[model samples]
Target: MGSRRRTPYGPGNPGASLTVHPLEGCRGIRAAGEVGLATHTIWEGVLEQAVREGEDVYYLELSEVTFVDVAGAGALAAAAGRLGAGRRLVVRRPPPALRRTLEAFWPGLPAIEVTM
Candidate 1:
């Protein structure tokens, strides 16, 4: 098992940090941010990395995310569609806004997993 680093979230963190940890052939994407237009660059890079590595299951840990926008949701959909064959995208936790967006756009795409 890996240890979780103590990183503060919000304006103080500026979402400057993201850890891509691979476990049991699965990728863990831990992000701390609002994940909006301003931080889309980093989010984009993260998505690219997840795709490039062809993670079997992209476990996006967004429990720390306080907010997310439509662009970000779109990115998730695009990334999920572009993932390697048989690989799926799993979003462990999403803000209400993002969740609603997912329910609207990807209502039946089981590839995008939403957790309570």
Candidate 2:
């Protein structure tokens, strides 16, 4: 186990925030509001820590995410790739912007699994 340092995106803001929730033997994160460069930077670090501490399966619930820039999408894809085979980084309920970004720039990244 490694240290999980709290970032700005971690349970700080009430308006736009990212929270980590524990799933059944796995870890999950929910993101809200705009996922641009600043927030994405914090989010990327949080996701990296989650992946480092989580089990084989990790979940990123993006249902409340309103917007995601290219960097944010790239961060997501990077995390997915870092997980490698036999591990899963499932993205749930991705917004249209994120979906389009992934389809356009990262069409061949099989590690990123988007659902609903």
Candidate 3:
């Protein structure tokens, strides 16, 4: 729940723009474009890096993320679970269309907010 920071919006390694930025004491991760079977490895890598770095809270600024498949969502959930109770994974400002998708598949997700 800090200020929103503008980041690069485009494709990343392997056609997925799964971007990340370490906000000093905070671990702010911004994942855009798509995340699915084609980019699950990238997604997992981002989460792993956050965990390994011992980030207290992994703020996944997912507003710009265009899509998230089952495997992608699972990867996120798995990472959050791995972090345990004290740790947090915050997702912010998702696209207008993904609401129904989030509700249908991952309804009780924690740390997810529709900021705009």
Q: How does each model score on TM-score?
A: 0.75, 0.73, 0.65
lDDT (C-alpha, whole model) for all candidates: 0.70, 0.68, 0.61
- Candidate 3 residues lying further than 4 Å off, grouped into runs, are 1-25, 96-116
Candidate 2 lDDT by residue in tens digits, 28-113: 76655566644655577757965686467678778876777787788878787777567777788988878989999989677677
Error of 2 at 64 (Å): 0.4
Which is the better candidate, 1 or 3, if ranked by lDDT? 1
Ranking by TM-score: 1, 2, 3
Models ranked on lDDT:
1, 2, 3
Off by over 4 Å in 2: 1-26
Residue range 1-116, candidate 3, lDDT tens digits: 12122333423334544454544555676666666555566778877776666656667777667877666666766676677556667667765445566667667766444445
* Total backbone collisions for each predicted model: 0, 0, 0
lDDT measured at residue 73 in model 2 versus the true structure, 0 to 100: 83
Query: What lDDT tens digits, residue by residue, belong to model 1 across residues 1-116?
Result: 22133334433345434333443445666666566655666677777777887657778888777777788889988888887668887787777888999989878775677886
- At residue 32, candidate 1 shows an lDDT of 64
Best-matching candidate per TM-score:
1
Candidate RMSDs in order? 5.0, 5.1, 6.6
Stretches off by above 4 angstroms in model 1 are 1-26
